[model samples]
Target: MPQGISTLAADTPTLSAANTGFMLICSALVMIMTPGLAFFYGGMVRVKSTLNMLMMSFISLGIVTILWVVYGFSLAFGTDKGSIIGWSSDYVGLSGIGITQLWDGYTIPVYVFAVFQLMFAIITPALISGALADRVKFTAWALFIALWVTVVYFPVAHWVWGAGGWLFELGVIDFAGGTAVHINAGAAALGVILVIGKRIGFKKDPMRPHSLPLVMLGAGLLWFGWFGFNAGSWLGNDDGVGAVMFVNTQVATAAAMLAWLAYEKIRHGAFTTLGAASGAVAGLVAITPSGGAVSPLGAIAVGAIAGVLCAMAVGLKFRFGYDDSLDVVGVHLVGGVVGSLLVGFFATGGVQSDVKGLLYGGGLDQLGKQAIGVGAVLAYSLVVSALLAFVLDKTIGMRVEEDVEVSGIDQDEHAETAYDFSGAGGGAGSRKAAPAPGDSVAPAAKTKKVDA
Candidate 1:
């Protein structure tokens, strides 16, 4: 054998068992985020719509997983045909791919890379479900997810991450998915809400969260899983950069939660649990894109800003009469923009990528690039999502009937309820009629009707 050939062969990148294990574990962590999102969204909606909220996120896990293996991965990460999208059928159903083939510049197998990306594809659409919580039809939502991912997500992923992708080539920084995931979903949520219109009673009804505890639990899961969502994007087990991202994620989230509580106390006269949970999510979204590029202090700034901004942005629904069911647009969209743009200012160049922000003396070049990327995604997602919602609304009906929505979406859409209260009355399933206002003899048997 020629010495040059032997030398090249010897230097070829090989799989690292540690990195592979790390990535696989990260994949599982990211996978759990969708269910965490389900619980997060499920708790924010009324009880009547809780199961429906959960189903919306859960269905994405099933649907996107199948689509990803079939063609989604190819379209998103296949050989890039142009800056717009990827084109190559070779990877469809992961055909002709070898188990030993390593991802470019990485130690993990290509299959591991594919599945990790698949988790991202799953959560993007699910994030939008929080916006359309109560009124959407199950069949229509399923169809919408199928079409939206095909048209919007796959192409956008290509534009951001595919080889020779426009944004990637232009040096726009999105460490995780600030633009392709959160901003895209947030803008899409707004567009769909515009088409679907407000819930039956927008500002008139209380429409408070059905279960704050559930929301908190879901938030905790999200925070836990987000370590993978952000740091795992590194696609390796490098202790230096990955550990930096991990610590940044934690500090940013904590800062945002505290900022949110402070804001809540001042604005609403109380520090609410919902504020804490929402604040943490806001911080998570903010740090996802910038964590790799910024220092721990930078992460705190990003988180604090995102927390305050998202808190205020959530009220936009009420002011503008749009009725984002669970503040998806406010938190994800706004926080995403905050994070992505802040990267231009906080990027320290040597830590992650070679880009630096204005504060770091990199000038407005990176910031402008971030803006363009954000605008392009925001416009594309909004227009495309609106058009899709309109077409679905016109043809097969995107929302449930007024009567069904008024009664309950869970019972009508899924034929089941989240909580069964039928067994609450008496022993052996005996019924108990409602007592007159003051007629309760025993406090233990008395039931208080809480407003939904």
Candidate 2:
């Protein structure tokens, strides 16, 4: 539904079965991304934390779905209020709308739009779990997801894509969710990590990824699913805009992957698999916003630029002393900003709207609009997410006790380990168990800082 793109205003009343079917497939594709993200983050953490990492991403599927069905759709897509939020009694619980009711202006049914957007709502918070990996208590993390989405994501979504969303009203062009999703999640990741504090041994420990294959698999799934995440934003394929977006998405991602591998080879003396996966995601994020508005060549430039930038940006955590464990801040935050801003330069004025980029001779007008969109989402998400984490930290606590963190958050948090140690054909498979709730403790190594 894209908050504002599909439902802002009603257009042709005639329903198109083809668009409806296309959207349903896109919705399913978007749903696959959450699991893909789980695998990606799951593989990036140390062996001890793999299950906990995967759970963090997976839990959003359960929590956000319930919330979205209840009031998330209304708060985000309902009628506008002061250009800040939305509300519609009918949308609550998704109970009142008829099955045949079409989205305000699109060819698909409202139910289809709601489910599609539900997938977006789910993944946005899941993206934040990467920063807090290996530390946060599952329950506290769950609560944070519930609260953060209600306070931050819902309103911000309304602001960017809602019918009267301030950004939408301002004519800001967010073809997908550079501002709403990537920047929103990235800023929130930065915010929550700052308040929650660093993971133990964040800098000094080698902390290498446990399984690059899993990371690559997750990246592949994310890349494959993103076509739905981007092209489907248009809500219909009646025009060729959706088709253009699909091509650009592929173009940017490939360019970014190559650029990142090139950079890694030059800087680290090898073309690491992590670099390739990260670069691919960086390109996906960059093209997400600009793909619908730019040419294939422009997409290549965008992806290549984002690739190098994010590859360099990932090292910032080591230098700046932030524990963005999975480079969410680097890939998503930086890629989103790069993509959102580039629209002001590469926009061709022929695809999505008449607005042209500076290079296209549209002057700086569109650039200013994009800056406003980027700054607003970044500032709001950072401040508000920090506040949410701080409140949770003070009341119920966010991180687990030091020993649980050191031993493994997986066992303590979920009562299970990701892999069994027993030989392949053994009884009970030597399952590891969680520590008793009030067990004795021993001191482990203290957290440390190191240069990249």
Which one wins on lDDT?
2
How far is 86's C-alpha from truth in model 1 (Å)? 1.1
In the predicted model 2, the residue pairs found to clash are 4-161, 10-104, 11-105
Q: Rate the local accuracy (lDDT) of all candidates.
A: 0.90, 0.93
Question: What shift in Å separates residue 289 of candidate 1 from its native position after superposition?
Answer: 0.7
What is the lDDT for 7 in model 2? 31
lDDT of 1 by residue, 180-273 (tens): 9999999999999999998888788889999999999999999999998888888886547888899999999999999988998999999999
Q: Clashes in candidate 2: how many? A: 3
Report the Cα lDDT for residue 401, model 2: 98
Q: Which parts of model 2 are misplaced by more than 4 Å?
A: 1-11, 425-452
TM-score of 1: 0.92
